[model samples]
Target: MLTPKQARFVEEYLIDMNATRAAIRAGYSEKTANQQGPRLLEHAEIAAAIDAAKGARSERARIDALWVLQRLVFEAEADLADLFGDNGELLPVEAWPLIWRQGLVQGVEVLELFEGYGADRVHIGRLRKIKLDSRVKRIELIGKHIGVNAFRENVHHTGLDALGDRLERALKRNH
Candidate 1:
């Protein structure tokens, strides 16, 4: 049971998950939307409604954590060799495996080669550069998904007591 405005806010929030923008779009005053948005989220009923909507959307899209992890793993393990032939020439897009073509390749740049300039220009050949998605980045994401801090550096912290002890030791040495 939501008021029309609240319902509208929920709908707009689903569009981008930007609560303040959603509040403004739902007819709230822009000046107060920054406060109003988070306050609305604090309501148990509103939170429940948002959760239900998210669950429904996830179900409709057939996407879950496992699905995302699988995709990340595929991208992380993508092989560059798959994009080239035994002769060491880059394969055409049609020849590339479907998974690599769809998920690994980020973009392609083509440079048309020509001889001469102006009207005398003759088409020679083309140079293609294929940009692949960052495998290291994908691996890092997979590590994060599985709760492995593979890419994170260990941070060591010294307590105040430890610092005090070190200072006393230094003072004794000086004395």
Candidate 2:
């Protein structure tokens, strides 16, 4: 559960407002919104609650929420799917981007997803760490577009758990 102010900020941000805008709407200084916005979003419980709300969200609202969530994580837009199936499947193959900018091709749908997301160049500094090839990552994206089809019917909508699992496994394999 978020504080009233925090909750209001999240609610406003979910509607397509940036942190600065949301902060202003939530009755905070626009400058403070930048500092406070990331802190509020960093709360694990708050994130979990937001994810729960987004899971059952109407298709239209869900898409909107996806835009906000992508901006929150990657600080940029993403190509995440819009319509989720009743069986809890992502109808759209597009997933979110990871700000990866590289010259090598990998099986990473997040690259193309970012391109589709209309992510801004405002924060290219932090996003520069990702290494996505100039050429589309065809093989990586061929079957992993959604990156969460691994779930059965009881699947979670945002697929964070699945993604975390994959990331953890990859990290273990790497080191």
Best by TM-score: 1
Candidate 2: segments with Cα more than 4 A from true spot: 58-143, 146-175
lDDT of each: 0.89, 0.53
lDDT of 1 by residue, 27-52 (tens): 99999999999998887888889999
Model 2 is weakest, by summed lDDT over 10 consecutive residues, at 123-132
**Please, what is the TM-score per model?**
0.77, 0.35
TM-score of 1: 0.77
Against the hidden true structure, what lDDT does model 1 obtain?
Answer: 0.89
Q: Which sections of candidate 1 miss by over 4 Å?
A: 115-125, 152-175
